[model samples]
Target: MKEKLSFKKGHRGRTVFLICDVIFLVLLMVCMLIPLMKVLVDSVDPSTYGLRLIPKKVDLAAYKYILSKSSLYQPLWVSVYSTVLATVIGLLLTTLAGYVVIQKEMPGHKLIVGSIMFTMMFSGGMIPTYLTIKQLGLMNRVITCVLPVSLSAYNIILMKSFFEGIPGTLYEAAELDGATPMSIFARIVLPLSKPALASIGLFIAVGMWNNYMNFILYITDADKKNFQVKVRELILSDGLSGTNIGISEDMLKNAMVIIVVMPFLIIYPFLQKYFVKGVTVGAVKG
Candidate 1:
């Protein structure tokens, strides 16, 4: 009759462990959610000095004031253009470089792979990189946003690992059918690589969207500045007191944070399912 119970002595330990893990996860989620809720509430609340879980009153004045500004549009366009362009270009380059690097028959392959990995561990300092950019005449241009960050070692490695897991017989079949390397890559490899592409594309897009340092350092033209720059300016300009935007500093800051973060929140849901699968493929591929 005692054996009828599923809760054996050893099973009790695992059950307790699971319960503790669930409690910890719940606490962690609450911690994260509280701050996000506070930000959302404060951004729309007229009085933003204090943190309140539930806002006493609703106000859209902060949103109206920020959105009504004319200068905001140019930076928004720049950000969108640069982010989309950079993500596309970077993804293509990463995929191609990764494919080439993974090919065992390619000559000097080890040296090329080593060089790529070497850059991952180290890089030329900012000053030298800036000097190189200057020499290349990339300053204050849209290309400056895309070119400098187009190739990432980590992304390339992840793509290579993912590609390595594809069976070689497929490629051999393609070659027997008179398919060139480019044709095989375009038709066979790319068609099977949605998860990897989505994962890498999302990473590049987020990086470009959040990039602030590059714009500040290299872009002197106001027309070339992106959304992040405008956000920074609004945050740092005495909390925008000089602009007389009619919104409180705290509220404006919160509003800007929400505005900047909104795109990623919108985007992540579409990629959420593929992200885990992509990362697992890249990480665990033999």
Candidate 2:
């Protein structure tokens, strides 16, 4: 009778927690939806309508204009190229570093992990970072945007924690089978840690896609600038001057925002399952 009552209470508590979670999710969705809907409406409507919650009319003129303009295409490509390169490089390096740090017998492992973690809590200021980039001959180059901030200390820690959670007996078994560390990592660890890798990869991809400060500070060439930097320049130059530029400022702003965000929207949905699973596993283990 006591066990039955305990089980019933536990079940009831879970039900209540689930209900609360659903309510919170619904409210969060509504909050996010409002701004997204506003941007969509503004992108399609004529800007002269002015601060409208609902669009007066729907049209694709803003998108059409932006695409047709040659000036926008190069920056868009630059941003895409930079983001892809950075994400790939970041994922590889972070995974390797994480794996190394999780090895209990690895020499200087603690010191290495400590140094990496220390960087997470602190960083050199922008001026110093820029100077270092200049000293390294990365300034005014496309590689500069991708290389400087490729591997984040936080992502490495998360990945290391995920790796550490794997049973040590598995590694011992692999060794008994004459498996080297590389083989064990590739065959056993990599397959088991897909969720964690996917989550970290998505995080790195988003950071790369949204990055603008690096481009602004390191890239001086207008043609070398990424989409975000280009959009800012366009907004400042035309919006502040009150020059029509054959398109309404608001429409341009809305269109640029949509362009920047649309890729994330498309990619994130497909990766949502992996991201959730990986994050949950990592959290539980860490």
Candidate 3:
């Protein structure tokens, strides 16, 4: 009923290809690992100067400068505050909006969805957005970071795609059991949407956490300067000369970059399975 598979001469060629591929991948891994190792070494170097793979001396003044500064804590708190709010609000609103658009029976479903899709490709421009924020008195406020970017058309579409992949019979069954739309969404749909929620929530959290430009624009208060902004000024203006004698500018900068990035680097591995599953399912199902 089925022919036996044979490579014959092609087997040798396939083996050669595999060997080349592995070599190339190992080289690529080495290239990436080298730079990261250099950063780690330099950040702890007592007197950093150039690209160093080995530390001349191990000192943690770079990390200490940040941790000891009371003012720096404010920025860390701001990032956390904005990220948490945006993720929660974005997920709830996007999930509701995504669920509504998938109901073919709803009036103007096509129109509403089309309008949303339109905004993704076009925007009112930067000046208009800035002015709008200013007019709303959101200017110079910590919450400005959360409100302006709390909803993204792309995230909504992602949720919509994930929701559409769910079997329609589930909804019908829930309706027969006298579940309202809100109840069905809260209990049934959300329970099945963990993959999507994890993926999208991670995206929002990372974006908000790394949002440097938003703070530069909206938060002007001296006490409200975020972690990135503070580090940027330190590097640009010269090291905290009076306070940090032994620590180098490059060392502090590298340490700050690592601090911001390490959380996500640690987190992404845990969510990688769900993130890949969600995106793949949405792509195929949509």
Number of the candidate with higher TM-score, 2 or 3: 2
The regions of model 1 sitting more than 4 angstroms off are: 1-20, 242-246
Q: Write the per-residue lDDT of candidate 1 for residues 1-286, one digit (tens) a residue.
A: 5774555856988999999999999999999999999998998876656768788888777777777778889999999999999999998899999889988889999999999999999999899989999998888887887776767999999999999989999999999999999999999999898899999899999999999889998999998999999889867875444236566777777877888889999999999888888899988973
Cα misplacement distance, residue 142 of candidate 1 (Å)? 2.0
Regions more than 4 Å wrong, model 2 = 1-11, 47-56, 239-247
Worst 10 residues of 1 by lDDT: 238-247
Q: Could you give candidate 2's per-residue lDDT for residues 1-286 as a string of tens digits? A: 9999999999999999999999999999988988887888888887535445677778777877777778888999998998889888988898888889888688887899889989988999889988998898888998887876678888888888888888999999999999999999999998998888889989887888888999988889999999888888888777322225555667767877898899999998888888998888777766
Cα TM-score of candidate 2: 0.90
In terms of lDDT, model 2 sits at: 0.84
lDDT of 3 by residue, 22-114 (tens): 999999999998888788887788565677788888888888886787867877777777789988987888898889988888999899999
| Candidate 1 lDDT score relative to the true structure | 0.87
Candidate 2, residue 63: Cα displacement in angstroms equals: 0.7
Instruction: Give the whole-model CA lDDT for all candidates, comma-separated.
Output: 0.87, 0.84, 0.82
Pairs of residues at least 3 apart in sequence or in different chains that clash in candidate 3: none
Best prediction by lDDT: 1
Q: After superposition, how far is residue 193 of candidate 3 from its true place, in Å?
A: 0.8
Q: Which stretches of candidate 3 lie over 4 Å from their true place?
A: 1-34, 47-57, 239-244
